[model samples]
Structures are given as structure tokens and as C-alpha cells.
Target chain A: MHIIEVTQLQKHFGDFKAVKGIDFFVEQDEVFGFLGPNGAGKTTTINMLTGLARPTAGTIQIAGHDGIREIKKVQRIIGIVPDESNLYDDMSGYENLVFCASLYGIKKQEREKRARQLLKQFTLDDTGSRPFKAYSKGMKRKLTIAAGIIHNPTILFLDEPTTGIDVESARQIRTMIRSLNNQGTTIFLTTHYIEDAERLCDRIGFIVEGRIIKVEETQSLLQEAQREHIVEFKVEHLDEGVIQEFLQSFNQIQVPRISDQTIRISSGRPIELMPYMEFLTSHNSKVLEAKLVHPSLEEVFVHITGVEIDRLKKEKEGKK
Target chain B: MNYRLMAYGNILKKDMQNYYLKPPNLSWGIIFPISWTLMFFLRSGSDVDIKAILPGVMALSILFGTTSMLSVTITFERKSRSFERLLLSPISLNLLMLAKTTGAIIFGIINAFIPVLFASFFVDLGGIQWTLLFSGVVLIAVTSTFLGLFIAVSVNEVFEAQTFSNFFRFPMVFLCGLFIPLEQLPRVLRPLSYLFPLTYGADILKFSVNHQASINRIVSFAILLLYAVGLFLVSTHNIKKRWIY
Candidate 1:
């Protein structure tokens, strides 16, 4: 079932169009990833869907409620975990969770019970009594997510859930997202990390500069990515001259300069490794290691959105 | 309706814990009243009767306590993005904002009494009208709290909130007939004094404590109530216009 159906949604900030009349739908119990570069209107689109930003023009129907008109009804069934941790700094983890549950009209006893359960589920039981301001980045993120789900919302909107957390915490959060999806919570996720989309999202949408370029099943996108053959060669004594010579010799393939001592060649057709290996060896470029590169969602994102990989990497660095 | 009430109560309780019960705010609540009372005596000299300045002291206490509490709490939460959590809740914006301001209102009311408590030790309290005093205190607290909410919503940073609050607070302290009577002011400034809601609030406290007021008692209460409602409506409008986007 289509739990969320947005049509020609638009959000304008003065002359800049943040979300320019885009359309999309999310199915019940499916994890949908909205992937884009920074300033690509990913957060703007989520804000519109969640009723934080009123659209300049469009229609949004969530769980049969008009997103703009009956927003309170829509809000009742949805959970939002903003990019920042928005829980109270003075309150404890348990207090924050219980307080969030109360906002959803949960009974006091039930809210306390649920808060305890969520603290345990998020592995925050040990630190439940500690103030949120004292929590580490990962624990703060965990508590914020727990607060969002305190009411057991039918759909959860997570914006950059794992952006700045530790590796272990990010992995645990991913596991929890999977578990929540398994238990029939529809997830609408927006993320900077393409790998997160590949691992957790069933279907992915690529939004760039306020326009959604493509939305497709993850498996299908990966299949399209598989059509291209790629190989990375780690070498010594490599330079711009050697790269030029290699590209000139192998005119059928495109060699992207990986580094001074490494190069990656990709093409639509299968690459003949022996000739390229022999040519590099004759040029005094020692090929230390060569490996076949399997395309992932990162490659698919680049291919579909046409955004530079360096730009995305720069966004990660800037966020960190 | 029941669910909304529950939501309101929860928001109120949480804000009370977060912004009101903290040691700084608790100390502030106690200290502001004492300081204002002491300042009144120092400015007017020790021989000035405490009863004559009780209304001004109470009004100033409520104003400073409420505005100071809200200036920090609201702006800090907004900066931290915690206010967005309340904005996204299932309750109506009106209810959520009212719940957020209720703590400050209560704090202001309590702050008003600390001065009165100090006065009762020194003055004979038999003839004072308790009902009128309570009504005046509640109105002053509500109006002052809504004024703080107005200032808080207008600014983004806590320091900006403090600065902006002073832009209103210090002006009202002088112009609202808190320390100076309206008739004693220049004729031009008397009209200007009437522009401030605190003017009506101070007048009400005066009528309650001294049985003397420049404006009629009914008009003072009505005007004070109107200002409270007006400030609240404008603040909520600001939130919808600026904060939501």
C-alpha cells in the first residue's frame, strides 16, 4: 500500500527553489532511501513531507491525511528524527523518551514501560539515568532515535541517521533500522552515505538540485551498475605520462586517475587484463596488485545523478 | 481533548523541569526578587515605606524573572533544535506554545511573592486585600511571560534573546509607571507609558496593594488581559512564520 503519496511538491525560499515540484511515493513497510549531495534539497523534501516546511505548491497525502491540512493527524502516525539531536539536554535519556511518548498521548504507565523497553533495545539501559548533554555522540543519536519511535509510529523519517557516529554505533543503528522494518514500520530515510542506501533501503531515489533524477529498486539499480566492467591496478613508478600512454594504448577503456601510483580502468565491455598488464610492465610501471572492482550504489549514484564523487566526499568531510 | 490536555501537561512538566527547577533558575527566581527589593530601597532611600513601593517591586520581579527565564530557555532550545521536537508533536501549536510559556508564568508568580514575603515581615499585613493582590499577580505574570515569549521568538540566539529582551524590559521599567507615577511624568511621556502592557500591569498591582491607581481598576485589568492575549497571539504568529520554515 502507498502510505505516502506526494504530487508536484514544491518549496521555495525567496528566489531559490529548494524543492521544485518533485513527486514520489513510499510504500507501507518498505525502506525508501532519498539520496543526494549536500544542498540538493534532500532535507527540504523531508521537511515538506513531515510538515516542517510548508510547500510553495503541491499535494501530500500521508496515511490518508492531507499533509498540509490535517497535519496533526499525519503527525500522529509518523516519527521524525531530525539531523540534530533535538531531545532535552537537561533531561535524562529515559525522561526524554517518556516525555516524547507523552506528546503522542501515551498513558504514563505505558510510556514508562515503553521508555524502559526502548532504552534496553537501544542498549542505553546502563546510561538511561544520565543527562542527555553528557552522552557521547553515538548515545545521543541512539536516544534521539528512540525518542522518535517512542510512540511506535507507523512510519519513521530519519535524516542522516549515521552521519557522524562511531562505526559500531552506526552498524548497530543499521541493524535496528532493519529490525524496525522487519516489524512493519515504513522507513523514509535521507542520507549522505550511498553505502547506507545500498545496505538498508529497498528502493532508492536520487535527488540533485531539487529534482529527483531517478527512483528505482536497489536490486535493479545494482544490476544496471553490473553491466559496466571496472578494474583497479595498484602500481609503482606511475606518473601522468604513463597514464597518458596507457589511455592512448588502450583506446577502448577509460582510465580514471586514482592516484600517482594507482589507476582504475572502466568500460562497457569486458577488459582484457593481460594486454593492459603487459603494456604497463613494458612502460616500467610495476603493477603490484590488480583487482576486479564490483560496482555498488555509490557508482550507481554517480552514474545516475552525474554528481562528482569528490563533491560527495567533500560533503562527508564538511559534515564531520 | 483529553489527549491534548495530556500533551499540554507533559510539555509543561518537561519545561518546568528543564528550565524552571534547575539550580540557576531557582537561584535566579529567589535572587531577582531580593535584588529588585533592595534596589528599590537604595534608589528611594531607606525611609521610603515598603508598602508604597511594593507594587513596583512585585511588577519588576515578575517582569525580570519571566523574561530572563524565557530568554534563555526558548532561545537555547531553538538553537539546539530541541524546540523543533515540540513543534513536531501531535498537539496544536497554540497548546504547545502555551505549555512552554506556562512554566515562566508560574515562575513569575512565585517571584512576585518573594518581595511580598519580604514586606510582610516588616509591614502590618491585616488591611491588604488578598484577592485583588492574587489577581494582580497572576495578570502581571501572564502579561510579562507573554512579553518574554514575544521577545524569545523574535531572536535566534540566547544572547540575542537577552539583548532583545532588554530592548523591551529596560524601557518598560522606566516608562511603565513602575517606579514613577504616570501623573508625575511629562504629559507626552504619560501617553507613551500607556503603550506598554506593563503600565496597565503595574497599575493593577498598585490598585491591589495601595488602593490607588491612575487608570480605573476595571480598565487596568481588561487592558492587561488584552496585552497578554495580544502578545501571545503575535508570538505564536511569529513562530509559524519564522521558526517553522
Candidate 2:
């Protein structure tokens, strides 16, 4: 059964529409990623699903409860970790988690036990006694996620789970997310990192300009990206003469660029790597390495969404 | 325990820690009332009877203490975005707001007694109506906390909350018969005085402490209750309109 079903969901602020009637669904125990650029209504849609924002139009059926009319019932079964940490800063991390669990009607002893287990799970056990404000960004993010799941919610909504944190922490959080989903929790993840969706998500939805452009299985999208063939050759002491002659020899091949002893060749059809290696060898240019490159989810995302990879990379770096 | 009560207790506990348990806030709650008492004596120069001004001072103490704590805490939480966590919990908006305001209501009630604590040392409190006194203090706390909630929802910044609280608080001090009697005020301003919730609260305190009141006891209690409910409804509406979406 689908864990979440949203239809024609729209949110408007004044005259501007933040989410322009988007529809999507998350299946049980699957990681459904809503990937988009900044201000692409990813967070807005998540807010509507989680019962934080009221929709201007359409319906949300979450776990069989009307999200708009019966948000309180839906709230009990779901958890939310906002883009920013919403846990109390003045309280200890442990205190914050226990308090959040208590809001779900967990008894005192059970909440304490769960808080301890989660603190250890998130590698925050040692610093659990410290105030939330004193923790580092990564620790704070981890604690916030821990708090979100303190009651072992059926579905967890994470907004930018890995943004603005250290690399090691981000990796650990991704691992934790995977572990949670493996344990039968449905996850709705919205992220700026296409790589995150590539690695963690089961199905991907591409949203642009407040509208969903595409929603497809990860493997299917990657397979479609494979239609374009690319080959890269790492050569030693590569010069302009080699590239000019190499292009002249292979007219169907397009040499995208030559930089740092590497030449990237692209074509609609597969190119024979041996011919290129022998051609370079005959020209007295030593070919160090040559390999066919598989297209990444990022390539598919760029192809479908039409947003330049450079712009997305800058947004990711700026977030970091 | 029931889940609703559990949510209420947890929210109330957290807010009490953030709003009242801190040393600075605790000290401010206690010291502000005492300071106001001292200032009253210092300004009136020794001949002014403590009993004559006790109702006014007690009403002022509850007004300042509750509004200051509740408004600042609400605005600060909203600014830091921590309030969203409470808003998203599996509790009704009314329950959540009640839990949030209970801490400041308790703080205001405690503040109302600080002046009485000082007054007990100098005067005979044998004839004071203890039932009326307790009822008056509670109603004042409830009304003042709701007023704080109103101010908190109406503004975005901590400073703005403080400033907005004063916009109602300062005017009520003069017009509510806290320091001056309602009869002594200009005829044109007396109608305005009745509009403030504090005016009825001050009257309740006066009847309780001095055994003298201009308005009927039932009318004062009813009006104060109405104001409390009215302010609470308006603030929650504002929160739903502005913060939820």
C-alpha cells in the first residue's frame, strides 16, 4: 500500500504559487526522493505532507488519514526533521529527545531508554548531556533526526538531511537513513544533492519551478542515461597536435575537452577503445589509461530537468 | 497516562524550564515586583500607606511579570524556529497554547504574592479576603498571559514583543485604576479604562485587599474571564493564519 498519497497539492503565498498543483506518492518502506533546485517547492510540498502547511488546493491522504482535516491523527504516525534543527537549544540532546518522545505519549521510562539507544545509534552518546546549542552542526543535525524518530514513527520526512554538515557526518547519516528504511520505515526525502538521491532513493521525482517534471525508478532512469556512450583516455604529455589529429581520424567522435593529460570523447554509438589506443600509440603518445564511463544519475537529472550541473554544484558547495 | 495529558505535561515542563527555571528569568520575576514595591515607597516618600497602594502594586506585578516572560519566550522561540516543533506535535492548537502559557501564568501568580509578602511584614492582614485574593490573582495571571500571547503572535522579533507588550501594559497601568482610582480619572477616560482587562483585575484586587470596590464582584470576574477567552482565541487565530502556513 502507498504510505503517502498526494493529489493536485497546491500552496500559494499571496499572488505567488510556491507549489503549483504537484502530485506524487511514497510507497511503504521505500525511499522516495523529491530532488530539485533551490526554491523549487520541495520543502513546501514536504510541509504540506507533514501537516505543517495547509494546502491551498487538493488532498493529502497520509497513512489513510486526511492530512488537512485530520492532521493530528497523521502527526502521531509521522516524524519530521526540518531543514534547520527545531529541537530546543537550551536543553540537553538527551532531554530534547525524551521530551519529543513524551509528546507522542511514550511513558517516561520507555522514552528515556529510547533516547539513550538513539543517542548511541547516532554516535551522540558521549555528548548527549551537553546543551544542543553547544554541539557542532553535524552533531546537531544528527540529534535532530534522532529526536524525530524517538517514537519510532512509521514514516520520516527529512528535509535536506545532509546539507551544511561535515562529510563524515553526512555519510554516517546516509547510512543511518538506509538502516532505518531497511527496518521498514518509509522515508520522504527532499534534497539538493542529486548524489544523495542517486545513492539512497528507490524512486526519484524531479521537480522544477514548483512543478514535478518527472518521476521514475532510479534504475530505469540510469538505464535510459546509458544510451549515450562516453570514453575517456588518460594520455601522458598530451598536446594540441594529438587532439587535432585524433578528431580528424575519428569523425563520428566528439572530443569534449583535453585537460591534464585526459581526453573525453563522446558519441551516440559506442566507440572502439582499441582503435583510439593504437592511433595514439602510432602518434608516439603513450596512453596511460582508457575506460568507458557509465553515465551517472546526475547526467540523467541534467538531461531531464535541463538545469546545468554547474549551477547545482555551486548550490551544493554554497550549502556546505 | 492519557496521551493528551502527556503532551500537555511535556510541553509545559519544557516551557517552564525555558521560561521560568533559568536563574536570570527567576531573579527578574522576583526582583521586578520587589523593585516596583520599593519604587512606590521611594516615590511616595514614607507617608503613603502600603495597604492603600497594595492592590495597584499587586496588579502591576502580575501584568509585568506574566507579559514579559510569556511574550519574550514566545517571540524568542518563534525566532529560533523551535516553536514549530511544538506546533507539529500530535496535540490540538488550543492544548499546545495552553501548555505554552501555563508556565507564565504560574510565574505571574507567584509574582503577585511578592508584594503581599513585603506588605505582610508592615500591616495587619487579618481582615483580607483570602478567597477573593486568590481568585483575583489567578484571573489576573490568566488575562495577562493571554495578553502576552496576543502580543507575541502580533510581532516577529523579541524586541518587538517587548515593545508591543508595553504598548498595552503602560497604558493599562494608568487607566486600569492600578495607581490611581477610576473615579479620579477624567470622565472621558473612564470608558477607556473599562475596556482594559486589567481594570477589572485591579478592581478585584482592591475589593480583596481593601474591602472597597466600585464595580460588582460578579461583573469584574465575568469581564476578566471574557477578556482571557477573547485574547486567547484571537492569538491562536493569528498563529494559525500567520505561522502554520
Candidate 3:
């Protein structure tokens, strides 16, 4: 069963179309990543799904209820951890959690118990009495996530949960996310962190310019990248002219370049490394190391999105 | 309905604990009114009727406390994005507004009563009718709170909310018969005074203190109730329209 189903979901902000008719569904207990650059409508889509923003056009069904008409039903089943840690600043961490629980209609005693459990689980037990505004960025993020799950929601929407935090805290949050998925909660996460998506998402949808360019299983997407084979050879006393001449002789090899005694070759098909090694050795060059380089998820994303990962990363940082 | 009520209670409790209980807010709501009443007593010559002005002081307290507190609380939450959490909850919007307005109303009533309590030490309270006074205070508090909600939801920033509140509040203070008798006002401004909810509250209080109401008690109650309901609907509608993106 799909926990979230969005069809032709669109959102327009005045003259700009933020999310232009995107469609996707997240299966039950799946960690679905929505990947995009800044201002690419990833947040707009999440807002529509979570009922924080009205869709200009399209339909959304969350856990068997119409996302618009039956929003209360959807709200009861879904927990949203917004990109901002927006709990009441004046309230203590424990108070924020209990308040969130109370909003979900948890009984007073149960709210207290659940709040305590979440604070401990988030490694915030010692700081539960501290006002939220006094918390460090990492602590606030942890507390926000804890509050999101205070009622044990069936589905959790985490928007850039690991962004702008200490490395240790980000790792801890990732572990918590994996654990939550293991406990049968459907996770819909939107992030600019390619590694987080590659590691946590069962499947990822690449969105660019308010459109989903592709959605595929993580492994499948990586496997599809195998169409291009890259082999890098390090040679002692390398002669660039001779290597270029030899590489030029093979029409199948494309974009071969020598940099600092290392010859990199790209081919549509897997190259026979034995012939390349023999060619280098015969040319008064000693082959030191040769290794095949498999494309990373970051590479696959760059290739699919037609944008450099660094450029996108810069854009995300600039937005922050 | 019950779940919504639970959400309302939770919101009200949280607001009270976080915003209303703060020292600055406490002083503004309670101490400010008492201080203002004392100022009035000090300035009043022997010819001034202290008993006649008591209700007006109480009405002013409700006005200032309810409008300022609600505006500040809403603006703070909205700026911090904490208010978004309330919107994301399963509770009905109406219930959320009710909870917020009701919190302000409770604080406003307490604010109004504090001055009265202080006044009783210096002024005789025997002539006042307790039932009429209580009812009028409740109605005024509710109306003022609803107005505060309307202003808060309409504006985006704390300063804007306060400015808008003042735009409404200062005019009401001058025209609501709080200081000047309604009949003493010029013919043109008399109708304008009736437009302010504070006018009815002042009228009710004047009658309660003097034991002779110029306006029928039933009529005053009904008009104030109507104002409360109308303002409540407008504020809730504005919240729904403006809150979501």
C-alpha cells in the first residue's frame, strides 16, 4: 500500500510556478527521497502533501484520505519535521514535546511518558528542562524530530533534517531515521545531501525546475550508470604524446587525457585492460597502477540532472 | 469535537504557560491597569466622581490587556514559526482561534478585576450591582480579545500588529466614553462612539455603578454578544485565509 500518492500536484506563487504538475507515490515503510536543487519545488511538494500549503491543481491522498478534503485524517497519521526547528522558543524541550503530543490528542499521563521517552531517545534527557531557544543547533534539530514523532505517527515527512548541523549530529539523525524506517514508519525525506539520499532512500525521485526528471530504485539508478566505463592508469615516466597517439588509434576510446603521469580513458563498453597495459609497457613506460572507477550516486545525479553536483551544492548553500 | 476541545485546552495551556505568565506580560495586563487607576485617583479633584469613573477604568484595562497581549503572542508565534505547528495539527481552525481568544479573554478579565479590587480600598463598592458588572466585564473582554485576534492575524510582524492595534485602540479610548460622558460628546461623534464596542461596555459599567442603567441591560448584552460573534468569525476567517501558503 502506498502511504502517500500525489498526482499532478502543482503550486504557483503569483507569476512563478513553484511546482508544476509533479506526480509520485511512496510505498508503505519505504524511505522515499525527493532530490532537487534549491528552488526546485521539493519543499513546495512537501508542503502540499503535509497540508501546509494548498495545491494550485492536482490531488493528494495520504493514508487513504484526500489530502485536501480530509486533511484532519491525514494530519493525524503524518508527522512533519520542517526544515526549520520551529518549536516554541520559550518552552522547555520537554514542554515542546508534551505540547505537540497534546495537539495529537494524547492523554496527559501518556503525553508525559511519551515526551520523556522521546527526550531520552533523542539524547536530550539531561537538557529536557532547558528552554528551546537556549539549545544548540544540533539539540534543537534533535528535539524537533523527537516532537514530530512524539505521537508515533504512521508516516513522517522530514525536510532536510540533517542540514546545517554538526557532523556527529547529522550522523546520529541519519541513524535515527534508519531506525524509524526499520520500525515500520514510512519516511518521505527531501534533501540536497546526495549521500543521505543514496544511503537511506530505497528509491529516489530527481526533481529539477519543478519537475521530476526520473524516479528509480537507488541500486537500479546506480546500475544504470554502468553504461559508461572509466579506467585510470598510473604510469612511471609516462609519455603523453605516445599515450595520446595510442589512444587515438582506438576509435572506441573517447576523451582520453593524461594528467600527472596518469592516463584516464572513458569508453562506452568495458575496455580490455591487458591491451592498454601492454601498449603502455611497449612505449618505454612502466605501468604502476590501473583501476576501474564506478560512478557514484553523486555522479549519476549530476549526469541525470545535467547540472554539476558542486553547482547545486553551492546553490543550496547560497540559499542558506 | 472532543478531540478539538482537547487541542484547544492544550493550546490555551501552552500559551498561558509560555506567553501570558511572563513577567512583562503580567505587568502590562495587571499592574499597568492598577497604576492607571491610581493615576486617575491622584489627578481627580474633590469635584470628580471617583465612583462614576471606576467602570471606565475597568473597561480600559480590558481593552489594553486583551488587545496588546493577544497581538504580541500571535506575532511572536508567527515569526518563530511555532504557529505553523498548530495549523499542521488535526484540530479544527475554529477551535484553535477559540482557544487563543479565550486565553486572552481570561487574562483580560483578570486585568479588569485587578483595578477594581484596588479601587475598592479607596472607593465605596456598595452601589455597584455585582451581576451586571460581571456580565459586562465578560462581554467586553471577549469582544476586545476577538478584536485583538483580528489585528494580529491581519498583520505579519509584531510591530505591525501593535501599530494596527493602536490605530484601533487609541480612537476607541477617546470616543468610548471612558473619560468623557457619551452625551457630552458632540452630536457628530456620538454615533462614532456607538461604533466602538467599548462604548457599550462603558455604558453597562456606568449603569452597574450608578444602579440606574440608561440602556436596557438585555439590549446591551445582546449588542455586545453580536459584536463578539461577528469579530470572532472575521478573525477566524482572516486566520484561515492568511496563515497557509
**Candidate 2 off by > 4 Å:** A230-267, A270-294
- Give all candidates' CA lDDT scores: 0.89, 0.90, 0.86
Clash pairs, candidate 1, are none
Best by the TM-score measure? 1
Model 3, residue B212: C-alpha shift (Å): 5.5
**Worst 10-residue lDDT window, candidate 1 chain B:** B32-41
Candidate 3 Cα deviation (angstroms), residue A164: 0.5
**RMSD in Å for all candidates:** 2.9, 5.2, 5.9
Per-residue error for A250 in candidate 1, Å, reads 8.6
Better TM-score candidate (1, 2)? 1
- lDDT tens per residue, model 2, A1-320: 98899899999999999999988888999999998888888888888887778999999999999989999999999999999998888899999999999899999999999999999999999999999999999999999999999989999999999999999999999999999999999999988888899899999999988899999999898888788788888888677887788888887776655565777677788787888889888988899988887878876776667666567778888877
Clashes of 2: 0
Candidate 3's residue-wise lDDT over B170-243, tens digit each?
98988988888877889999899888888888889889887645567788888899999999999887876677
Candidate 2 vs. true structure, TM-score = 0.90
Identify the superior model by TM-score, candidate 1 or candidate 3. Answer: 1
Which candidate leads in lDDT? 2
Predictions' DockQ, in order: 0.76, 0.65, 0.59
Candidate 3 accuracy as TM-score: 0.88
